[model samples]
Target chain A: MTYCVGLLLDAGMVLLSDTRTNAGLDNIATYRKMFTFEDAGERVITVLTAGSLSVTQTTIARLREAIEDDDATGETSIMLAPTMLKVAEIIGNTLASVREDIDHKMNATKVSVSASMIVAGQRAGGAMRMFLVYPEGNFIEATEDTPFLQIGEHKYGKPILDRVVKPSTSIEDAQKAVLLSMDSTLRSNLSVGMPLDLAVIERDACRVSSRRRIEAKDPDFARMSEAWSNALREGFSQIEL
Target chain B: MTYCVGLLLDAGMVLLSDTRTNAGLDNIATYRKMFTFEDAGERVITVLTAGSLSVTQTTIARLREAIEDDDATGETSIMLAPTMLKVAEIIGNTLASVREDIDHKMNATKVSVSASMIVAGQRAGGAMRMFLVYPEGNFIEATEDTPFLQIGEHKYGKPILDRVVKPSTSIEDAQKAVLLSMDSTLRSNLSVGMPLDLAVIERDACRVSSRRRIEAKDPDFARMSEAWSNALREGFSQIEL
Candidate 1:
């Protein structure tokens, strides 16, 4: 299981992803799921993948290959897509093809290998857009009303986002919200673990401005974790029937 | 769908369940999930059921019939059961049987129907105990190290439980913890809705001492809901990245 979140705000976008993946309880390993495509000032897009690692890794490799291919066309690339919507379409198409191919090979064992991706970024002068690409290859964009998207082990972390996020939210505050949200998810579930990758893209900058890896014992996280626990206990104690 | 939670604390046991049930997004209705059986002062057992309402409702009805029988015996009754553990065993066995019965009826359509329950209360001098009965009729007790059990649409509400609940938590605090927990779930999942039911059993009392039904527009819930939103915003602002 994994937990990846992307928030598109007025100030910019924030992306966070955990590093834990498992084939089974005993076969746990850490695999970074956040992938970035940066042409610095030209474009900076971050993709967070979850579900079958094989499908995501293959799709990403194919994407990178497409970007490098001089002959790559709209059918084979997200980089050359005209709009964020087209970029999303290219990603959805790739994810779908990768999943079906993997499913065919794994069908002998009757196993499903569905994967989803959270794609967010800006293209120099373009607006920052965020999308959740579904396992079926369909996709939904973060509108002004929604403003954020989450994938993988999402339920445990959704309440905070539902309550706090908006398109007008500042990038600085968006970072805190995603971290604390991740904090909540990490505490309740063992499958989503630490050494989290966090990236911040200032709107229209076309580049990720800040990137941090929060290790298991990062002090800021420790403070936030303890503070959240205290707030809950105190908040709970103060509520009267 | 529903969200039900049970906590076994030194102060006693707390059981909470939402009343909303839905066959699908368009088919929503209310049906109480918390059922209490008390031969007051002798024993008190509160069962919170989730999943396959048909199976759960039938199982509870059968258990009630056995307890209501005039000449009930250990083989056909819960009232005559020697201990709370035995009561759990009987409930689990009955649940499994009811599920299998329903499964057979649905077999032609290839639909799968299953049920699970959280049973908690005290029996005279026996210690307060709680068990999470699985769909397979197997069960596990809540211990000091892990003193709470949740069933159905649970993840959306579990973070607060992880941060605040403990073995020594008072029944009153546990009650608030669960209500707040369910409130979170209600905000995040459309599948989970309200008119929440909560029951608290004081240690060794052998009956529910306090219970509440919080409706959608209840003033207290609304206040807490707003306060939580404000507090979360405040908390987020106070934290530095």
Candidate 2:
């Protein structure tokens, strides 16, 4: 299981993903779920995935191969896609095909092989856009009314996002919003774990302006988590019953 | 869907439940989910239910009928049960049998007819007890380490309880904890709604010490919700990004 969030803000996009992957309580491991592709000022794309590890990993691998293939046409690679929508299309198609292939082989055991992803970034002349791509190759763009897309273990982290996130939120505030959102998730759920990967893409920059890998013992993250906890306790005490 | 939470604290117990019921989004209605039986200083018992409304309603009706029956035995009536555990056992058995009867009738459509309950109270000379009774008649007691039990739309309301609740928590704080817990669930999930039923039992009192039915326009509830939201936003702003 994992918890990944992508915010579409006025100033930029903020993407964050937890590193925990677990088949069971005893079968848990750390796996980075954020993938980045950039052609400097031309285009920049970040894909945050959640679901079956095999399908997401394979789909990402296939997308990379296509991007690096000399014979690959514009339709075959997210980097060369004409718009953010096209980028989502290419990734969605790849994920759907990979899922189908795996699902067909796993049908005997009645297992599911499906994954979903959040695609966020910008192209040179195109508007910055973000989408939540589903398991069946369908996707929906993040609108001003709902300026964030989340996948996996989302509910526990949703209340804060519902209250705070807006299209007008600044990149700095958006970053804080996502980290705090992730903090709520990490505290409430055992399936999501430490060593988070966070990426910030300044609007129109077409490249990741800042990236941080937060480990279990990172002072900043620990401080944020502690501060949030203390604040909640204090707030709880102050509320009149 | 519904949301009901019960806390076992040193001061006694706190129980809160939502009143929303739905067969589909188009068929939503309000129905109370908390029932209480008390003999003042002799004994007190409260049942918080969730899941199939039909099963829970029928089970409660049957439990009431038995209590009024001329041949009612100690084992058949919650009011006459020897201890809180026995009361939970009687409720569990009644719930399980009722579910099986309904399930047998609903087998053709394959609609589930199962419900769960939280039994909380204290017998005159016995210790305060809380049990999460499952559909199958088996139940688990809330331990000191995990002093809270929730059913239906639980995850959205769980993180706060996980962070703030303990066996030593005061009954006043416990009531606020469950109400705020319900508020989180209400904000995140459309399936759970108001008005809410809250009850508190003081240790050895053998009766509900306090009870409140919070409506949509209740001033106190409104103030609490607003205070909580403001506190959360203030807390968010205070945290360093």
Candidate 3:
């Protein structure tokens, strides 16, 4: 279980993922769910995955192998893809392939192997784009009508996004929205835990613009946590009889 | 799908439930999920159901029949039960029986006919209590440490509960908490919609104390919704970069 969120705003894209992974309640471990590929001035791709650890790890490995392949073509590697759509296509293909391979083996044991990802980035001449890739390999782009995509333990954090997030949200605000959303998820769900990876891709920067790994004791997150509790208490007190 | 919540507080017990049901997304309809059984000055019980509508509807129908039976006895009727625990036990056992019956009949079609309930109220000479009943006819009480119970679509509304809710919370505040919780769920899940039924059982009052049905065009809820959106907008704007 995990909580991963990606926001595509007019300012840019914000991606956040939790590091906790659990096999049953007792076997909890930290595993980064985010993968980023950058070709400096050429292209920048960020992927935040949530689901079967085996499938996600394997799919990411295959994508990296393709990126490092000297004869890599657009269809073979997300790094060299001409457009964000093609990049999503490559990722979807790899994920679906990995999921199917694992699903078949897991079926015998009465288990499911499923994974999904939020893919966001830009190519040299292409637009800044974002997509939510499903377990079955289909993808949908974020539009102005709904500028954010969330996966894994989404319900706990969805309300804030619904109330305040929009396509025109500034990058700074978008980052806060995603972090608060993640905070809500972390509090409600034991499956999704701390040590968060946050990355922001400023519009047209074409590379990872800002990155931070927030450990459990990070001061800013601590402030936000306290602030949120205070705000909720104040709001509750202010409600009338 | 449906969303229902119940709170037990010193001021009272507050129960809120949505009225949307869908077999599939295409087959959506409105059906009340909150059922109240009361015998003035003796006992009162409100059951909020979630999961298979078939199971819940039938279970409630039977419970109502027993309450209305001319030869009603403590063994056969909720109204005749001496304590709220007995009432909850009766409801839980009835729900399990109905679910098992329906599940067997629907086996070939592979539809789950299971349901859960949040039961909250007080009986004369008995303290106010709240219980979350599982499909297996077992239940867990909500203590002072955790004074609320939610059934169906609970996640979207959980953050507020984790931060701001407590046993001493006034009924007015409890109402707002449940509404805010429901508002979040409504925004995130298409499967859950309104009008909503809200009930509050004041401690020692022993009867259905206060009940209101909030329709789509309800002015109070509409105002609260607008205020929340504005508050979120203001909150986001005030956060410094």
Candidate 4:
């Protein structure tokens, strides 16, 4: 299980993901679920994955392989795609194919291996875009009305996002919103643990503007989480029945 | 789909359930999901249901029938049960049987018909208790450590309960918490909607102390929901990144 959220805001896009992966309760492990590809100034793409490790890892590896392939074309490599939409298509196709291959092999054993991803990026001279790619190769783009997309263990963290996020939200505030949302998820669910990966892409920058790896004991995150909890409790105490 | 939550506090128990019943997005109707049986002053048992309407309705019908039966005894009728635990078992068994009956009929079509219930009550000489009855006839009681139980479309409303609910929480605060929790669920999900049933039982009262059918246009509920949203947004704005 995993938790990943990406927000497309007026300032830019903010993405965050937890690193906990587990086959079962006793088989938990830490694995980075955020991947970035940059041709620095040409285009920048970040993919945050959730679901079966085998499917996500294989899909990512195939994507990286395509980027390095001598014969790679716009349709074959996300890095070479002309637009953010094309990049999403390439990633979605790769994810779907990898999932199908794995699901086919696991069919007899009745195991299910499916994965989804949040693709956020900006290409030079193109609009910044964010997409949630489905396991079946379909995808949906973030629009002004709904500026955020989340995948896996999402419900626990959703109410905060639904309340606080907006198209006009600042990049700084967006970061705070996603973190607080993740904080709620972390507190409510054991499956989504810490050592979170956070990435910010400023509009028109075509590269990740800033990034942070928030470990389990990151003091700033800890303080913010505690502060938010205190604030909520205080607010709850003040509400009239 | 439905949403029902039961909270056990030092003062007593708080239960809330939405009335929306939907077979599909296009087919929705209003139906009460909360039922109460009281031999007032002797015992009071409240059943909040979620899942297949057929199963829940039938289970309640059977429980009602047995309570009115001339031959009903401690082994069959919940009103005659010796303790709150026995009352839970009677309800659980009836629910399980009803679900199995419905499931068997729907088996060929593979249209699953499973249901679950939250039974909270107290007998004249017994302790106050709350049990979450599963579809399999097994049930788990709410303890001091975790004094809340939720069924159906639960995730959206869970974080607030996780933050505010406690065995020591006041009945007034408990009502506020469950209503706010339900507010979140209503905002995040369409399947769980208006005209909620709220019941309160004060400790050792052996009857429902107070109850309210909160309609969609209920001014007090609407005001509280609005206040909560505003408070959350204001709190969110003050948070630091």
Candidate 5:
């Protein structure tokens, strides 16, 4: 019951994630699901997670612990990884191991624990990249032909992304697209609630260029959502049957 | 592997269903999922189905057989049912029993068989009604607060319906809304395919007033789809980020 999206545009990468997590209909809570690791201009990586909160939180916590370890190396710490690809691999493996550990513990009770993540960032002198890391510790990179990745409660918000996003899209437009996409999802699903975490990485900067947390009643976000809804209504009325 | 939607509006009722059935990605075929039964000028009923092909097809066949039975009564035949509510009850019971029958036969292998349906129609002196029949013989009617019901690959197309559909919407506009909704589903899902069956029943008509099968290459449908896509794109670009 989460919705997170990442867009890899020629100009940069745009990412958004919702904060709601629920054990059941009655046990709902808000939890941060976006994590960032930035060595300023040297390297920057953001991870947006969805699925079992326990698995995602543990995976992210372990990744952070690795970064702070005195003996941390490129192979063990995402922040010190040699490239964006290796960073994704390190995170994916951590996530998979954490999920398996939880799954094994819960096996006796027939409970399941799984998670997925969208990793987007870059290192100095390297191409900006974005990947969707699966629960099995495998990942797929976004390319020019398909420059976006979404995980969890994605269908309600996907048609707009399919129509509006492309590799050559500007950073500003990319941000708009992801927010509007999230708007559609929010309206359609009760499980995916606000506030939301948003991050933007400018190409070659090797650091997050902008970050914002959109609260449930942010005036600017409300205005944009209202405007977009009005536009869609107007557009719908004009289409011939 | 299907998409069927039914809308109940003040002007009338509209229903649309895709004709795709698949055992897997490799085994796909065309199968009609919309069924109409009318004692013309007396009562008109349309059923749109999704899920297990065996269960749905068998249920529909049994309903048809009951209609033609010499001993058929209000308790056994939907055509002779006293009210639209009774008709829905009959259909729901038949569907549930058939599902259980099939489920029992498939029990050894643990393969599941289940299906759901949307039933919409009006009787001579009764009001038009639409009900979403669940697999367990229970059903819920569409009300002014929620004037539409969709089954199978429903999420991708739901946001537009949430925004556009209302009890007072005109039949023409309702048709347009459902088609646009289906267009979105078609773009997002490969399982929901072409050659759609569309049926409209005007209030008090007691029979289908208009019906059309939109083929894969239907030019008018193509034009409408193209116009909608363009309108959405234009709307997306005009919105203030």
Candidate 6:
């Protein structure tokens, strides 16, 4: 299980991903799902993944292998892709192939080897873009009307985003919104855990602007969670029947 | 689809259910998911159901038929059952039989004829109780540690309930909590809709003390939803990053 969200706002893009993976209660592990590729001042791409660990890990590994290849081209490398849309296409194709390979090996066991990802980034002199890439190699970009995309255990954290997010939201508020969204998810679901990977890519910067890894005991996160809880209780009490 | 919540609080029990049924996006119809039976001052039993409408409707009909039979006995009827636990048992067995009957008839289509229900209420001289009865004729009761049970499209509405609901919450507060919970679900899911049926059973009263049906344009409901949305935005703005 995983919980990952990407916000495409006027100010920038914010991406957050939890690092918990479990096959069962006894087989839980921490595995980072957020991957960042940057050619500072040229392009920055961040991918947040969910679903089968094997598929996502292999897809990321292959994408990296392609990036490091001497003959890496726009056809084989996300970094070399000419546009954000093409970056999504490259990632989606890689994910689809990895999933197919795994499915062929595990098909007789009635298992599904599907994974999904959120691709958020910008290329030099281009617009910032965000997409939800599906297991079938198709993708949907976030729009002004619906400016956020989430995958894996998304419902528990969605109501808040629905209420607070908008295209004009600031980068600071966008960061807070995603954190609170993740807080709600963590409290409600056992499979989604910390430390969280948070990245902010300012519009047109073409580079990672800020990044943080929030652990369970991170003081700022702890304070924010406590303050949000208190605020909710106070707000709930104030609402008249 | 449906969204029904049952809260077992120190003050009493609160049950709310939405009334939307759909075979697909276009085949939607309104069917009451809440059924209440009360021998005023003696006993009250409310059943809130979700999932296979055929199974749930059939189970409720059978339970009613047994109650109306001249030969209805302690073994065949919920009202005559000595304890709330016994009442749950009777309801569970009835639901299981109904589901099994339907499953047999629909076996060739590979469809699941299963349903889930929350049974909530009290009988004179008995403690108030709530149980989530499964399609297999088994059930689990709400406890002090977790005083609420929800079925069908529950995740969207669960975070607030997790944050605010406790066994010691006041009945008025409990009512508000559940309405807000349902409001969240209705906003996030099209399958769960208005109007909603709400019933409250006060501790030791052994009968429904209050009930209301909240339509889409119900003034109180509209006001509450508006207030809640405002409160949430205010809270979000006040939280520090």
Q: All predictions: root-mean-square deviation over Cα?
A: 1.4, 1.3, 1.5, 0.7, 1.0, 1.0
C-alpha lDDT values of all predictions: 0.88, 0.92, 0.88, 0.93, 0.94, 0.94
lDDT of 3 by residue, A1-241 (tens): 9999999988889999999998899999999999999987678999999998999999999999998999999889887787788889999988999999999999889899899999999988888899999998989988899999988888898888887788888888888888989888989888998899999998888999999999999999988877766766665566543
lDDT of 6 by residue, A147-166 (tens): 99999999999999998999
Name the weakest run of 10 consecutive residues (lDDT summed) in model 1 chain A.
A232-241
Instruction: For residues B101-163, write the lDDT of model 3, one tens digit per residue.
Output: 999999999866779999887888999989999998999999999888988878988898887
lDDT of 1 by residue, A148-231 (tens): 889999998998889888888888878888988999999889999999999999977899899999999899889887877676
In candidate 2, what are the lDDT values of residues B157-183, reduced to their tens digit?
888898899999988889889999999
Model 6 scores what on Cα lDDT?
A: 0.94
lDDT per residue for candidate 4 within B155-202, as digits (tens), equals 989999999999999999999999999999999999999999999999
Task: Kindly list the per-residue Cα lDDT of model 4 for residues A1-241, writing each as its tens digit.
Answer: 8999999998899999999999889999999999999978889999999999999999999999999999999989888888888899999899999999999999999988899999999989999999999999999999999999999999988999999899999998999999999998998899999999999999989899999999989999998888888888888877887
**DockQ pick, better of 3 and 5:** 5
Question: Alpha-carbon error at B75 in model 6, in Å?
Answer: 1.3
Residues B87-142, candidate 5: write the lDDT tens digits: 99999999999999999999999999989999999999999999999999899999
> How would you encode candidate 6's per-residue C-alpha lDDT over B1-241 as one tens digit per residue?
8999999999999999999999989999999999998999999999999989899989999999999999998888998888889899999999999999999999999887789999998888888889999989999999999999999999999999999999999999999999999999999899999999999999988889999998889999998899999988888899899
Docking quality band of candidate 5, CAPRI definitions? high
- Fnat for the candidates in order: 0.62, 0.69, 0.52, 0.66, 0.77, 0.68
Assess every candidate by TM-score: 0.97, 0.97, 0.97, 0.99, 0.98, 0.98
Which candidate tops TM-score? 4
- Cα lDDT, model 6, residue A7: 98
Worst 10 residues of 4 chain B by lDDT: B232-241
Question: Residue by residue across A44-156, what tens digits does model 2's lDDT show?
Answer: 99999999999999999999999999988889989888988899999999999999999999999998878999999899999999999999999999988989999999988
DockQ (model 6, Cα): 0.82
